[model samples]
Target: MAELQMLLEEEIPAGRSALLDSFTNLERVAEYCESNYVQSPDKHRALEETKNYTTQSLASVAYLINTLANNVLQMLDIQASHTSLLLFL
Candidate 1:
């Protein structure tokens, strides 16, 4: 259980770093496209869709991570209380 918690704690930061890196890359790509060429209506629509999808996917992943962290903390809290009770008796 301690190992699992530690792994998750390590993973949460890595996940956040990945999300930031992805967004940074996306921004660079957008800036490059804007400076280099004119996009057609279809291409612009496609870009918008892609951006929306990426945003939603990132949100979902973040939500999942938050939920997992909360669950782990709750489990640890319960276990800690149980251990304390056992020690008390």
Candidate 2:
């Protein structure tokens, strides 16, 4: 459990940074594509859809991470209280 927690703590920030970097690169490419590669209305619409999908995916991941962290904390709190109650008894 300690190892798993430690790994999550260590990796999450790195993962977030990587995700940010990727998103930045993606935006730059998308902008360039819209300005240069997207010559048709259909292509422009496709690019917009891609951008929206990626944004939604990232938001979902962030929400899930927040939910997971809260659940883990709640579980730990419950366990600690149980332990204390047992000790008192």
Candidate 3:
């Protein structure tokens, strides 16, 4: 568990940095959001308001992962269906 945690911590920072590095607008927003997030409850509302920044950042990453997963599943289903069709033929 500790090893997994350690590995994840390292990987997450790299991934976060990569995500942040992707966009100029998002980077600025994320920087402000991050800074505000640490300050106090007052700034927390800003983070809430900047939903697009956070959502876009995550969506870019999540979309690709989801798309790849969906593609793989679809390919597997097609292959299975093809096999069945071959058997019928």
Candidate 4:
């Protein structure tokens, strides 16, 4: 349990940083695509595809972060219950 906690503590921040970086990159790409679209309307389909791919990537990263958070919360709840039971004993 302690090891799990330690691992989560180490990983959660890294996962968060990754998620933030993905968002930052998506924003930059969207801005670039927007500017380029204005200059070349023919690239609209490619820009749309890029937007779709980035949106999917963001969703996947967000889901991973959410799952990690839920796991951490569940671990904390189990730890709390165990501690309470130990005190009661």
Best by lDDT: 4
- Lowest summed lDDT across 10 adjacent residues in model 2 is found at 3-12
Candidate 3 TM-score to native: 0.38
lDDT of 2 by residue, 18-56 (tens): 566766766766676566545656876777776786687
Worst 10 residues of 3 by lDDT: 1-10
RMSD, every candidate, angstroms: 4.8, 5.4, 11.8, 2.7
For candidate 4, the TM-score is 0.64
Go through the candidates in order and give the clash count of each: 0, 0, 0, 0
Assess each prediction's global lDDT (C-alpha) against the native: 0.66, 0.64, 0.63, 0.75
- Model 4, residue 58: C-alpha shift (Å): 3.2
Scored by TM-score, the top model is: 4
Looking at model 4, the pairs that clash are none
9-75 per-residue lDDT for model 4 (tens digits): 8766666777778778777777876777777767868678677877787787778788678767876
The C-alpha stretches of model 4 lying farther than 4 A from their native spots are: none
lDDT of 3 at 8: 46
- Ten contiguous residues minimizing lDDT sum, candidate 4: 3-12
TM-score of each prediction:
0.53, 0.47, 0.38, 0.64
lDDT tens digits, residue span 1-89, model 3: 44345434654455556545666656676788777778757765766766756887778867645554554565566667768999999
Report how far off residue 38 is in candidate 3 (Å).
Answer: 11
